[model samples]
Target: MTTHALVLKTFPAGSPRGSWPAEEFAARLREHGRGAEVVMDLVADSFLVVEAAPPPAPQDTSGHEASRLGAVA
Candidate 1:
């Protein structure tokens, strides 16, 4: 399987001020069809490493319900 890496800088998005939760970020990636692994530093306030699962084979999107949602880019 192929893998990809990403570097992320975290910041508060909603609610109270604090660093973004790693698990929540991971979950979002999973929802988008990518698996995520996060690495953090003790001193730094930002995240460093993220490894993601390979993208799945493309599926036909024509006539799918999601297509009607809106134009994707």
Candidate 2:
């Protein structure tokens, strides 16, 4: 499974309804180029915005750097 982290939170305008519309919020994320999935955090009682998965870590294949640094591990 992939882990997603919170990126943004937008509270209801005017009257605080204590929650945001899930669909609208998700759509908003898409519109804003976030394009992530939405999850409701019961503990915080707020919409938890998160991407489907975390980005992949960068890879280094060149052994030159490791050799130069004398990294044995």
Worst 10 residues of 2 by lDDT: 10-19
Q: lDDT score, residue 32, model 2?
A: 82
Residues 32-54, model 1: lDDT tens digits: 87656666555665454375535
lDDT of 2 by residue, 1-73 (tens): 6564755654333334664466577787798888667666666655655665566765556653454565445
Q: List the residue pairs that clash in candidate 2.
A: none
How much is 13 displaced in model 2, in angstroms?
Answer: 13
The local distance difference test score of model 2 is 0.61
Model 1, runs deviating above 4 Å? 1-4, 9-20, 43-45, 52-73
Q: Show pairs that collide, candidate 1.
A: none
Model 2, stretches more than 4 Å misplaced?
Answer: 10-22, 56-73
